[model samples]
Target: MPGARSGGSGGDGSNSGSYSGDASGAVTVWEVVSLLGKLLGTVVALKVVLYLLRVCLAMAWKSGGASHSELIHNLRKNGIIKTDKVFEVMLATDRSHYAKCNPYMDSPQSIESLVFNSFS
Candidate 1:
């Protein structure tokens, strides 16, 4: 045949070049390893972010205030609370709006005396 190779000769009449047995530009082992490393790093970073978020939420819960009240409500959904009165009162009253600066902090806030005097 016109394009056929002779015995022990390259089909194109060239030296067949380096690694000529497989020359389809296949991915190298290093490239595969690098890709896996990048993927693993990304997964690890995502897990770290998720863990940080959980930590922040836990801190918020312990610190109390509006978020603490909401956490209590969520716990009640799972039957953690024996009654709904506490949740209902917390829902009816927004301590953050009623207080100043970090309204959610667990502490007694003073109300304006004028409002209190009105009740007198």
Candidate 2:
């Protein structure tokens, strides 16, 4: 069949669909499947490692606080909110009113779940 490899000998006594690095000059179907499975596993493992690294880097900037003003103060101290105007604005805004959880933590928060769902 077209695009299919047969692991058998041809009419001229030559190996058909033979893979390299084997003295038998023939490759089994199970070997090909196993090799593909290993390749897929490696790719998935690498993706998981990359995702964990990204999460760690994002959480590195987080500075927990007790309240809105304290959170803004921490941000300024950490050189995130450089200008006084920005600091005042952030202080005036109550994160608890918008964020569903961890309002004082310096991290991205979703104000409304529906908004994100709409975008998706």
Give the per-residue lDDT of model 2 (tens digit) for 20-93: 65786588898899999999999999999999987675452566688888888877886677798998888888
lDDT of 1 by residue, 91-113 (tens): 67766655656666544567686
Worst 10 residues of 2 by lDDT: 55-64
Q: On a 0 to 1 TM-score scale, where does candidate 1 land against the true structure?
A: 0.36
- What TM-score does candidate 2 reach? 0.44
Residue 52, model 1: lDDT of 97
Give me the runs in candidate 1 sitting further than 4 Å from their true place.
Answer: 1-23, 61-120
Provide the overall lDDT of each model, using Cα atoms, as 2-decimal numbers: 0.64, 0.80
Q: Which residue pairs come into collision in candidate 2?
A: none
> Candidate 2, 96: how far from true, in Å?
0.4
Candidate 1 structure lDDT: 0.64
